[model samples]
Target: MQFESVSESRLSFVVCFIAAFVGCAPLLQAQTEPAAPHTFFRVKAAETLTAPVSGRLLLFLKPGSGDKEVSIDEFHPTATYVAAQEIHDLEPGEEVEVNADQLAFPKAFSELNGGLYEVQAVLDTDHNYNYAGRAPEDWISNVMALAGWKPGSTAEPELVLDHHPEEDAQRKAAYEKLKGTATADVARLEEFESPALTRFWGRPTKVRAWVILPPDYVKSGGKYPTVYWTHGFGGEIDSALVSGLRIYERMKAGKMPPMIWVMLDESCPQGTHEFADSVNDGPWGTALTAEFIPWLEKKYRMDARRDGRFVQGHSSGGWASLQLEVNYPKVFGGTWSTSPDPSDFHDFTGIDLYADHANVYHRPDGSAYPIMRDKGQVLATAEQFTRLEQVLGPYGGQMTSFDWVFSPKSVSGAPEAMFDRVTGDVDPKVVAYWQEHWDLAHVVSTHWADRGADLKGRIHVYVGTADTFYLDGAAHKFDAVLKGLGADAHFTYIPDRTHFDLYGVGDDRQGLFDEIGQQMWDVARPGKSWKNRQ
Candidate 1:
């Protein structure tokens, strides 16, 4: 639930139908004419936009009397028969007929037995579908009543495309409310366009952060140390606001030193970019260091030197902070990362992607790999999550998010998938690319001679022994490499803690912030205690 907990809104009912056409040219020709040996399923799509519609058509099938209203959260992609077909040159106000004979089931579902099933369809106009819900431009169809569906049965349903005005209004109102609720201590949203990112994206790309000034800033008029805080996957500016408030409360109570907390927003359409420079995510690390930090230092009364700048984050953000300190040792003084995503691919969530015949679904002993749970009980397996994400569309899931930040860009403008979706086959070539570029342990161990001096005593990591995602396995691997290299790194293993409550120390859920803030102060002003402050 690491990435899943960020968005509570149920996934919009969106399914992808990947049809295998034995004869491609004949299938296109058969759109106008009928072809033998082809099972025909037809659908009609009505568009609401003025522009022509072009995207995939998703078909979902469920057995028996399906739930009257199905949320994407309740729907299991593995249990349902999902397929997709592309519709092109579809005009608005025109209900176009689509030939379903061209659609084919995935290899796993190819041999499914015919039976009574409930069906639904969605027209993804933008081609970007995620679990968080649909954009205003996307369209969905009503669930078809249960009916007998056989391989050759010619059953067609009509689907209408319309905007969810209520949902849109709700989203807009929530954002407006968040903007209006900012306190005096928690500064308003600050955003700027990064030139490096803009050039890479071929458009103006905005980077945003919340700048929380210390109490009595104008009266004091003194430079303060800065903490660059980042959020985990699916997190937004609002998520950072809570942390900013905690920092303000602690400063006001004299529990911590007065410091400027910069809560950075790393969430994007692709997923949490984690501010790592990649071929897919562009030069985020470079933009953050070369552009965002410099502008922030000059704009505010900040201590711009390396000793005064610190980094901290959890989960994906944790990985980001760790990478930032290791990659640019001179830029930031230190990083305190907690329960970060896989630091070593060798133990990436307890599965080695580089191992021979490695499958994400099963172990070498053929046992399932656990994904989400509490205590020792397994709530979901890795295959269930990955396969579910596959049917949810190609964008905005944890697995695809990693590919976006780690894998090389393919000619199709999408990141080359690191594993086969159906078979869970790990591609060694992609693993090699990951190791040479984003593998934190590999990078640090290989380049210790050059970076070791600057990075010594700067790297600190913590993970729970019972992390919900099994992240501690990778943390152990990473720590072992650092130890072997004689690096002065700190790795803490908290007993009985999980990913969700790692920040808590006893009943104080926000205790970690106080600890991290003080640590930053110690690094900034050595031998100086909070007692020495006025």
Candidate 2:
């Protein structure tokens, strides 16, 4: 057995295989059982890669018109046949038969009668399938049309795996166009590498921030108040570059005050770390407070005092900013967090992980817990998302990202899973660790006497009632705790608003930026009215 090094290409291929296997399961019944009921389905797939491929294989099945273009999002794991297979040194042009009995199927698929279905085979060469978007290296098999197919049907369609070179070219061209259009104002964004992070990872780790300098700074020899803006999950330093440019534009136009904005990037391979000092994510809170902030202050013309420093973020960033303010009260003057991720674990995404026999997949009454949504309609369940992610490998995803940030390290050198992936059994030990360390509400409630005085009137949170991820539940829980303790924390709930548009005030989507800027200005320059801005 020869093991190969796992490169980006190989990981991508492996992930593709995982996705394909999780999507469809082919049936293969034993030939010895002549009188046995037909209880199997199978599909034959051929590899089309130029080089010999050795990785995982995935098969997907969906109820659709076989002539139409198939999308991976359209097929749900619960309603489809899904299976995985491991291959070693499989040469190009080799065909393999995938058996359905070895695959996992939802209850809905078990009772399915014979019908029309489309089957596809995904050959993942590198195990990084979930992150790859229609890349040519992600070899996908031709959609096989199975009409009137029942269990143990001998009519199996042969799928030929092929790459989409044209799509890849188009994606590259679009990215190049975006890069070419970046103006001189965008060049003001500076990137920073954190020594703390490098030491933690035992390698050079870089974190970027868009440092928008105050206009006319070369002539104006004065230090300015700083706003440390954190980005939410999937947000990178480049993504916030436009916001920094807009800030410069607003300042130049006299629509906003002259203040420095530090757009910090909190994204990691495991998702946004939320900058919480954790055993798993390696003291990010400490790094941000002790190392990053001090370096930033020294390098820029920033007012180093607490009164001049403030934090603001939305969603995951929101939770992080609030956490930073609460943890290091003297370091940051205040935090204006909006639509943050669960501040209270009691209502974490509407499911209490600490509950007895808690299962993320189902509610107490045995209803499916929703995850992805659009306009209040559920697109996928929590279980479906988790299962798909599990197939996609454990390193980089929303669920695993939380584990990397909150859970303790396991003997396997990875973060301990909060719940069993297959059974959805809540791990009592993990829950206890999360509550003690990561749960903001629990931390504040337990240590109110010590930290309460400094945190008073400094913690301001905003959330929409119709937040797509049900983040409002956690916000409400945190609000109750704050009110009970007379913590002087401000909590606002907007009506009929969703997470994406929480920042929108009236008609402008970027209105929240200006609103937050004015609020920060008010805090930095007390007795100055925002209405009387020059």
Best by lDDT: 1
TM-score of 1: 0.80
Best model per TM-score: 1
Give all TM-scores, in the order shown: 0.80, 0.79
- Please list the Cα RMSD from the true structure of every candidate, rounded to 1 decimal place: 7.7, 8.6
For all candidates in order, the CA lDDT equals: 0.75, 0.71
lDDT tens string, model 2, 214-288?
665656777878988887776767667656666777776766777888888787656678788777777788777
How does model 1 fare in lDDT?
Answer: 0.75
> Which tens-of-lDDT digit does each residue in 36-151 have in candidate 1?
44443455545446676777666666676655433344223345655566778667776655444344333223245677767666676665555355555666666666565665
TM-score quality measure for candidate 2: 0.79
Name every residue pair that clashes in candidate 1.
17-83, 17-84, 18-84, 19-104
In angstroms, the error of model 1 at 356 is 2.6
Question: Least accurate stretch of 10 residues (summed lDDT) in model 2?
Answer: 1-10
